[model samples]
Each structure stands twice: as C-alpha cells, then as structure tokens.
Target: MRCEEIRELLVAHADGELDDVERERVDSHLANCPACRRERAAFESTGNLLSLLGPVPGAGRSISARVMATVRGEDPWCGHIRRELTAFVDGELTEAEARPVREHLATCAACAAESRALERTGDALRAWKLPSMRIGLARLFAPPRARGRLLRFAAALAAACLLLAVGIAFFVSESGTATPPPGLLRAMEMLDPATLEILDQDPGLLEIVRDLELLESVTDEEVALLTLNGSGG
Candidate 1:
C-alpha cells in the first residue's frame, strides 16, 4: 500500500480494528518506509495518551464541582450575607443578624457595592410620593341606562324561568300522568293569583306546548319562518 493509503489505516490499525490481511499489509509498508513508520508511531503515541486520559468514573462530578466553585465568585461567605443585605437595609434584622452582613460588606467590595445599591433603592422608595386616592362607593352604583338594561334582563330571565316551569308541567301531563306531579303542585303553589287565573283561562295553551328538547332543537330559520307565517295570518 502507498504511504498515503497506509497512513489512513494507521488510526484504525492502532485501535486494532484492521483485519489480519490489512494489518500485515500496513506492517510490511511500515517496516520498509521510515516515514510511514514515524506516522504509525505518532498514531500509537496519540492512542496511548488518549487511553491514559480516558474518562475516570466520577471525573465529571469533580469537574462540575470546580466549575461551580469558580462561578460562585471569590467569597463563599458572601452568599448568605448578600441574601440578608435586603433585610439589613430595611432595619428588619437584629444587631446580631446584621453584624455578619456589616462585617462582610466592610471586607468584600462586591457585597459592599450590593449593600450600597440596596440602601439607594430603599431611600428612593421612601422618598417617592403616591397620589392621594378618594374612597367613594357612588361609582359602584350602575348608570341609569345600565340599570334599565339590567332590570329588563332580570324580567326576561324571570319570564323564561316561569315558562320553563310551565313547560315541565305540560311535558309531565303529556306523558299520561292523571294527577300533576308533587313538583308541579309546588310550582303552582308558588305562582301568583293573576298567573293562576291566566293558566285557568287557557288550559289548552299548556297542551299545545312542545317538549323542551323539541323547542331547544328548533333553529333560528324555523323561528323566522314561524314568525313570518304568524304575521301573514
């Protein structure tokens, strides 16, 4: 094999990946060619170095510990003191609690700078003037137009509920109940004299009423057609 071809196989040869025939060819070339022998030697040295430096089981954890230690900054004591600096600035900490933070700030330039920033922030907040707010319940009352809409909505809702109750009674009767259900009796008792008189005058209205399921299944187009026919009549 040519030196170039032999060099290509050198890495695989060093790794013992080459078959016996390919290894013999490469070995014959290396024995005669000093340049190829040097190339093979370089590959072998690199493999040996890589084997020596191959991953130790917990080397990753050791490296991570070092990286974290570097990232946490120069002072290990600053972490706890930095947390309490806010409380220290607010005068919320006792002298015992504040002493360590004070001593830390005095020695550590980074912590001292943070403490100064906290003090400035506290001072700015204390100096800030908030606009006075007038407490009034009058705004909670609805406007006249809104009140009218609300009243109309409430009346329409009440009427819908009454119609639903009457519909349920009609549905029960249609199912061949000779006497009204106890639920219907209670509903009738709750009705005013005027409503009872209206129902008495037009008992057939209840009989003509469709089931709620049928009424709900009705489409807007069907309602429009019904309205048009009613107007024509």
Candidate 2:
C-alpha cells in the first residue's frame, strides 16, 4: 500500500479497531516501513496519555444525547455541536458527548487532525514554564508628568532615528560612493549650487556622480547584461 493509505489505517490499527484483513495489510507495511512504525508508536504513546486521564465525569449521557440528536437529523456540523469538540478534548464533555466526538474523530479525517492539533497545543501549554519575576523591582516609577515628558522625548528620538535609517537605505539603493560618508550624500542632494561646486572640486566625487548619471541613462537590456556580467557600468 502507498504511505498515505497506510497512515490512514495506522491510528485504527494502533487502536485494534481495524478488521483482520486491513490489520494484516497495515502490519505488513509497518514491518517494512520504519517511518510508519514510528508514527504508530507515537499514536500509541498519545493514547497511553489519554488513558491516564481516565473517564470524564458526566460525559456518557451527553455523548448519547448528541448521537440521538444526530440520529434525529439535527445538523451535527452546527456551530454549537462543533464547538463541543474543544470541550470534548478538554475532558469537559460527559461520556455521551465524548463518545460521539471520539467516533466523529475516528471517521472524519479533518476533525481528527484538528483534535490532535488541539491535544498537542494543550500538551505544550501544560509543559511550558514561566520564569519567576520580581514585582515592582528595577522600575524607576516616574511621576506622570515626568513620564509624559519622557514619552515625548522618546517619540522625537524615534522619529529622528526613522528618518536617519530611511536616508541610509535610500543612499544604499542610490549606490552612493563608499568614499563619501552617507551624511555627505544626503547633504549633496539638498546642497545649494555653491556647495555642489565645492564638492565637484574633488575628482573622485565628480567621477562617482558622472557614473551615476551614466547608470541612470543605460537601457534596460544593457542593465540586464551589466547585472549578469557584474560589469561596473
């Protein structure tokens, strides 16, 4: 059998719910496939965990009632009934409610996947640990008026940092000369004619600007070639 077909049977096989023929097929496949064996082992281990929780109180009647309701042609997919799946996983459902959920999960692949995902999430949350924290320690406890001023100062600093970061990013995209500081590039963009003339006195600065203009005029195809060839132009 294909891996997927074998997988669909793994859970049922682990639960001993498969018919003899299907069980033999799964057993043959598992004997040869280490991955499927691992999967079966994992499911069996999770089943053991579930067994430890024992039976949920008051779940039998609820499961029977839900099954009866479903038999009466009530929509099992309705929101209220569907929401019970979560409660069912949490052991909040009585046996009656839990039974239908378990049967539904066994038959419906999507609901079964969701129930496993919920179970994994619950396991993770249960295993998670929070580090101990000291209360009100390492705090300045600034007065409200002072805190307001601090917030305004932080806002202004953040704005300034944002602008500086943007300027640097634009400079990189523009391929500003490494010889000149990024601030110099920004200054040159907004400089008066006299300031630009002074900058032009530097041969290296003038050469970079000339190359930038040539790049701006290059055709798309030429740019593609340049990119492919790693050409300076």
Candidate 3:
C-alpha cells in the first residue's frame, strides 16, 4: 500500500479495528514508509490530546433537545429546525439556506440573540487550556513528564511541517513541469469563454499553473473537445 493508503488505515489500526490482513499490510507498508508513519503518529497524538481534553461544553444541548422533542412527538417542525439549525451552526448551509437563515436571524430577536450566544460560546470554548508545567528557566532542568509531552508535540509538528513542505514542492514541480497530454493547448482554445474567465485569472495561464489539478483536468477536457471538433481532425 502507498503512504496515503497506509496513512488512512493508520487511524483504524490505532483503534484496533484492522483485521489481520489489513494489520499486516499496514505493518509491511509502514516499515518502508517513514513519512506515513509520522503522519499516523501525528494524528494519533492529536487525537489522544483532544480526547483527553473532553467534549466541548453545551455542544450537545441542541441535539439533545431535538431528540427529546422527537420522543415527545409534539414538535412536528423539530426535525426541520434541528437539521437547518445544526447546519447553520456548523456553517454548512448552502447560499440559499444561508440567505433565509440570515433573514430569519435579522427579524427574529430570539434567534439573533442565540446566534450571538453561540458565537460567544464558540470563542470561549476555544480558550480550553492544556496545563503546562513551567520549570525554572534553565536548559535540562524541566520536569520529566512535561519535557516528554513537549518533545513529542514539537517533534510531531516539525515532522508534519517537513512532510507538507516536501509534498508541496513535489506537487508544484510535477504540475508546472510535467509534460501535458498531447492536444492540451488545442482544448484550451475550445473551452467556453465564461469558463475561461476563471482560467484567465491563473497568472500562470490556464495551462501553466497546475495546483488545482482536478479543475485543470476538467478545463483540459473541455478545451480538448473544442480543439478536436474545431480542427476536424
């Protein structure tokens, strides 16, 4: 398995959900893949720390209320309200839903206040502080437990950053310099003028900047069809 495959499986492995075959594959792959191992370790450690921190206060209250209402069978609109309110709380609402919610919040004092309260609660919740032990300001004088966790966090962060930088470098080089599929430029000529508006914004030109690769491929396909039909080849 590749690094991405191993990295994804690592979570399951850490949770002890991997079957024997999957476990063996992850072990075999991790032996040859230091980067994936590090990514796995980083995520595991992050998950550990978050679990230790416990759930966010009152994050469940809205859901709990909805569940209770459903049990009572008295609030017919409960389901709709819960789904929309949860999506709005998570900023997952589409533009259409967002407009209605915004309008509702504007005219409805209760919802407007609830929105502010929720925002304030979110800000306050982010203030969850992990206790840090501060030893005397001296090299090699810190408490062992504090020093160990600190070192682990620092190492994980450094490794993660290095991996990200390397990955970005590889992607950039591949996208910018890799040989294009033949007739790519011809396709560019055929894409709709409106579609080209976004491509035109690419300082590297539509074909040159390759970071948004999936989008680039889509544009290329559109352009290629145009180029081929136009050329009658």
Candidate 4:
C-alpha cells in the first residue's frame, strides 16, 4: 500500500472498521513508512478528539439558509466542515458513493482541478512520511489484491447463505415428504409377477445394486439371478 493510500485508511484501520485484508495492508505499510505511521497516529488522535465531541453535531445548518444568503441557491456545504468538496475529499465518498463525484469530476474542470490539488497535497505529505515499523521476512512477500478477493469472498458467503436459506425453506416445506428417484420407481414398476417370484426364491443374490461395475461383466444368467434375488427381497 502506498503511503498516501494508507493515510486515507489509517483512521478506519485504527478504529477497527477496516476488513482483515485492509488491516494487513495498513500494518505492512506502517512497518515501512514512519511518516505515514505518524500520520496514522495523528488521525487516531483526531478521531479521539472528535469522539470527545460526542456524536458530531448533525446537519444542523439549513441548506437553504446559506444558499439564500449568498444568492447562489446552491448549498456549497451541506453537512460538516463547511465546504462541499473538502468534506467529500476527507474520505467521505466510498467506492459506491464516489461514483457521482467521479462522474462530475470527469465533466467539471474546476472540480477536477480542485480534486487534483487535494491529491497533490496528500502525495507531498506521503513523500515526507516515514514508516514507524520494521518489515519482517514473512510480511515482505505478500500479494496486493484486496478489492477482488473481498468481492469473491463476499459472493461465496452470499451463495452459501442462499443455499442454507433454500435448504431451510425446502426442508420446512417438505418435512415427511419422501420420494424415490424416477428410475428406481420405474424399475420397481417393472417387477412383474414372475420376476418377483424368481427374486423371492433367492435371497442371497447381492447384485441388486446396479452400480457394481464388476456386475457389468457378469453372465446374463447371473444378472438374471441377481435381479430376481433383489426383487424377491
């Protein structure tokens, strides 16, 4: 993980909000970059300071008030921190939530340049950041593919949950409802009177289980004998 990216994630990581893989990346980065580590510590300290504020004041400021005040009729700031894009840049937009910003940035030159400036600032900070950690041999040889792995893992978990839910619903609906395979039912129907008698006369025939591969090589007589023996039982 790059130092700048780690700075973005450090707050969430320290707060125990990051997934295991993300946590690992932060830990790995922290081991190498002391500056980023300090930034992370500073972020944690900020979080603690914010927590002391106790449930950050809500979106108390009316959007219409400032919009009307400036005659712009647009809320340049909606929630906290007093500026729209600044609040967004402070790690508010998630993977899904960032899509709108991305679309806007693509079309709006002013916003895009502002975003670039923010990124440059973050990059400069990372250049000076040092790792407060030592990387062990085991941690150096690691792969970096969190987004896909998380997606696949989530998909598998969802599939397993769906299967479990289906199983529960099926068993709930079908308790005491037992049915044989169609092939077995047909074979049972095929047991005519004479065949049943022949089978009944011989109980020791064990070739009723047709899956016995060796029985494929058995003589016709033996097959007949086994079939009859099975029916008799």
TM-score for all models, in order of appearance: 0.34, 0.26, 0.25, 0.23
Alpha carbon lDDT at 47, candidate 2: 90
Alpha carbon lDDT of residue 105, candidate 2? 71
TM-score of 1: 0.34
- In candidate 4, residue 137 scores what lDDT? 12
CA displacement after TM-score superposition, residue 28 of candidate 2 (Å): 82
Model 1: per-residue lDDT, tens digit, 1-233? 78889989999988899999999999898889999888888988987887887676765668887876666655657778877888898899999999888887788777887788666544433332212101111221235453333222222223333554554445434663323245643443255645544444432332232221222333455434433432332
Model 3 misplacement above 4 A: 56-233
Candidate 3 Cα RMSD (Å)? 30.5
What's the candidate order when arranged by decreasing lDDT? 1, 2, 3, 4
What are the Cα lDDT values of the candidates? 0.56, 0.53, 0.49, 0.49
RMSD for each model, in Å, please? 27.5, 28.0, 30.5, 33.8
State which candidate, 1 or 3, has the greater TM-score: 1
Q: After superposition, how far is residue 43 of candidate 2 from its true place, in Å?
A: 68
Q: What RMSD does model 2 have?
A: 28.0
Comparing 2 and 4 by lDDT, which wins?
A: 2
What digit string (tens of lDDT, one per residue) describes model 4 on residues 1-233? 67777888887887899999999988988998989988888878888787676664676478767666555323342211124455457577676766667676676555667677565443332232112111211132245543333223222222322333334334434652222233432343244445444443433324223321222333466445435534444
Instruction: Tell how far residue 193 is off in model 3, in angstroms.
Output: 51
TM-score of 3: 0.25
- Report the CA-based lDDT of candidate 2 relative to the real structure: 0.53
Show model 4 residue runs off by greater than 4 Å. 54-233
Count of clashing pairs, candidate 3: 2
Better of 2 and 3 by lDDT: 2
